[model samples]
Target: MARFLPAIGLWGGLALVLVAVNLLIVEKQRVLDDGRTVLLALRPVDPRSLIQGDYMELRYHEALVPADAAADTASPETDGRVVVALDADGVATFRRFDDGGPLAADEQRLRYKRRAPSGLQPDPENSELFIGAESFLFQEGHAEAYEEARYGILKVAPDGSSVLAGLADSGRRPIRP
Candidate 1:
């Protein structure tokens, strides 16, 4: 019975881990399927990686943290939600930091992280604020397909959690490999 107890513990722990992982996958899948689509204008960066295939560093044109806001010493590092107003085309433009109030009809919330520059950014001297992912990876030969990418399509949940669905061109067409 003592030997069986160890085996039982190991199997029980693995089961718990699997369940937790599966739950996360299920939640993200739900977000991708049912969340509102919001397009964030992209600021182009490098798009080639010889060792790891093609990728694009993503910077949101509409989501830049104001210099003053990033410089605020009161809260040097923070994670919170920011409100954006969606246009007719579903493109989102930053409105303000979320204050836990009701959002306007055209507005949606997006999660963000503000911190010291990681030095990997184009403007490393400035503080950094980012939403979703910092880069998008694609197949090695598909660099050209994403070169004209003008917007990052995000599927955003009601609670401000988001998933980077894909990249879109100027006409808002997905850039498929």
Candidate 2:
């Protein structure tokens, strides 16, 4: 019985790890199967981290919700959801910081996790809204291929959650495998 205790604990831990990995796989499959495809315009940003490898730091045009435009009813530092409009080309434009509610046909509600005050301050560049999927990591030697990217192909779920599916060129063709 004493020797079995360690075996039981090891199996329990292994089961937990398996469960976690399964959840991750299910979530990714959900995004790929059920998420709505939306394109977000990118303004050139290139980053290379020695430890993390080559990746592109995504800077979306809609990431900046103008200071005067974003309603400040909540505390200066808050996290919630936002509704953004999608143009004909599927590029997202900031609509409003809003309560979690239904949106119009052209709009999508996304989970807004952090409100960086310094970035949200009124400035020439305007207030920036940090949504998830800000950084996209790629293979070490694939940096050159993504340098000319102009849009982020996002698979936004119904709950306003999203995953960066891939990068797209100016012509809207996916530039990755």
Candidate 3:
């Protein structure tokens, strides 16, 4: 009977891992299907890597939260949410840091992570603020189609979790590549 213990343990651990992975996949799919669409103005930098193909580094215009609003000075690795007010056109602009209060009808929350600046950035003080993804990968020959992308489309859940849906043009139309 002791000989079977190792096999049982291995199979049990593998089953648990698979279940956990599937649950995560289901949660992300739910967010993508049911989350609110928010457009963030983008400042893109195109860079190519021989191994990773083509991609654009995305920087959101509204990514920086006023230093005063980020009152926690103890940790540089804090993660929090920022409230943004959506305009009629569905574009989001920074309003304030999420204070666990109710959001206004036109406002939505976005998750952000704060990290120490790498010193290579132009403005190190504000560079710590990272909102959503930093890059978007595209097929090798399709970089030109995304050159006109002016916004990074995000599907944000009610709890401030977000997924990068895609890119959009100035007119808010999704750019297909």
The residue-by-residue lDDT of candidate 2 on 1-177, one tens digit each, is: 998999999999999999999999899789878898888888798978889989999877645454454445452444567777888877787787766567899998766554445556443233345665889999888888898799888888888788888999988888974
Instruction: Specify the poorest-scoring 10-residue window by lDDT in model 1.
Output: 117-126
Per-residue lDDT value at 104 in model 1: 92
Clashes of 1: 0
Each model's C-alpha lDDT?
0.83, 0.76, 0.82
Which scores greater on TM-score, model 2 or model 3? 3
Give the per-residue lDDT of model 1 (tens digit) for 1-177: 887998999999999999999999999999999999999998889756778677899988845456555455543446878788999989998777788899999999989886565544333245667888789998777888889999999999999999999999999998887
CA lDDT, candidate 3, residue 55: 89
Backbone clash count, each prediction separately: 0, 0, 0
Q: lDDT of candidate 1?
A: 0.83
What TM-score does candidate 1 reach? 0.88
Q: Which pairs clash inside model 2?
A: none
Please rank every candidate by TM-score, starting with the best.
Answer: 1, 3, 2
TM-score of each: 0.88, 0.82, 0.87
Please give the ranking of all candidate structures by lDDT, highest first, separated by commas. Answer: 1, 3, 2
